[model samples]
Target: MFKVIAVAGSPRREGNSATLLKAALAGATAAGAQAEVVYLNDLSFRGCQGCQPCTADDTCRVQDELTPVLGRLRQADVWLLGAPIYFDGVSGQMKLFFDRLHHLTNEAGQLRKMLPGRRAAAIVVTYEDKPRDDYREVAQRLANYLGWMGRFDPVEVVSLGRLGPSDAAAARPELLAEARALGQRLVEQLAQQGRTDG
Candidate 1:
């Protein structure tokens, strides 16, 4: 079975981003893939300290909640990142998660990456504003960083906008469908690559 790691980067419980992430994980299961969702809000971890201890083997030395999670991330075939936009950028939790991923890069300035093998990833972002290019940089930069880590181009970027309590992405059928499609596509791509570990 292919394993997918879905990350919910929202601080709010049952928030729009988390809801869509769960939907995507459901779709992955329907596609014959095993998936796990990790909620950043529930974890007790700190941002990277730039200690460079991972330089020896690319293992973060923080020894917090994120340590084991990062280990699982390295073993997964696919990754799904879900976050909410805050002030035209990704949520603070999401930023911290990404910051901790510096272990994937062996050298400063991304000259060398230690993470072995390429994996597929999808990005989901929920925003309160209308869909615009201004907020796209965050996701795009994430994709670029994953590329630097030897991961495949981000399989999808789902940006849901005009979101409020009543207009949550989960409540929007079209957006939910998009989330499911993203998951299905990720599994299909993994199958095509013969990446199933089971």
Candidate 2:
């Protein structure tokens, strides 16, 4: 029963998305969460072919990088998906992975039982020049999609946007505080469940 599963959906290993996610994951770990981080860039996977085999077999027929990772994701009590926004949306790699999850969704279009009874959270980091809610639009849509397919609405959505190297350099204390808070929130939720499932 792992407490939380953190997915780093950035193509670049050391990209901003991964960096911020690490901060969040560090927080979760400090709060006593047994967290495993999956770096999607290291996995070899293709976009979903739209075949309905998983519906019949209750598993994806096209096995590749996602087979084991999806299993880990299914067993997790909380899923923390972190991705960078590109061109006003999630990165291509992240979108491909989510699209592949279609195979695991029930015929009625709900998330399969494998992912039921869990909570999801989205951590999106962007360097958008504008300070508007542009990132929130995409983040909420992602959270909504997860709610529909994963059967678990998000308990929280954290956005670290408009940040530059300067922020990380000049405001380390504030950044660390946010990271700790994120971690504490994740662990508190899992502890509320009284145990880990994945």
Candidate 3:
């Protein structure tokens, strides 16, 4: 069975980003994949210290609430990352979590230690009434980072705009449906690749 991990970067548990992530996880679960969601706001963790220990050992030395999360990310076959745009970027929690991912590559900037052939989805929620190119670019940049660091292939991006209210995503069935479909597609693609490999 494939394991899927969803990380929620919003401080609000029922916020738009977390709501979309939950919907996606539901789809993955229905598709016969084991899914789990991690709420960053609930966890107490610090940002990466930039000690560069990972340069030689290829591991994050700072042990905290995020340690186990990093471990699970390495073992999971699929990743779903959701974050709300805070001041034109990902939330502080998400940005800190991303900073620790430096261990995925070596000091030479070459891809070093990461699971190969995995899949990922970048979910970004913004409060802007009209989605800006910069917002989409943020999601795309996140997708690119996951692809480069985790060796995820075909990283899908889901960008939602005009979500000023915490329940905005919950109120929109179509948005939830879209997220669910994306999750299903990820699992289906993985299964197809497994069959092809076999």
Query: Among these predicted structures, which one has the highest lDDT?
Result: 1
- Which parts of model 1 are misplaced by more than 4 Å? 107-110, 196-198
Instruction: Kindly report which residue pairs in candidate 1 clash with one another.
Output: 1-198
RMSD of 1: 2.5
What ranges in model 3 sit over 4 Å off? 107-109, 195-198
Candidate 2: which pairs clash? 2-198, 27-183, 28-183, 75-198, 111-149
Candidate lDDT scores, in order, read 0.81, 0.67, 0.81
Residue range with the least summed lDDT across 10 consecutive positions in model 3:
113-122
Instruction: Count clashes in each candidate, considering only residues at least 3 apart in sequence or on different chains.
Output: 1, 5, 0
Better of 1 and 2 by lDDT: 1
RMSD of each: 2.5, 3.2, 2.0
Displacement of the residue 4 alpha carbon in candidate 3, Å: 0.7
Query: How many backbone clashes can be found in candidate 1?
Result: 1
**2 or 3, which is superior by TM-score?**
3
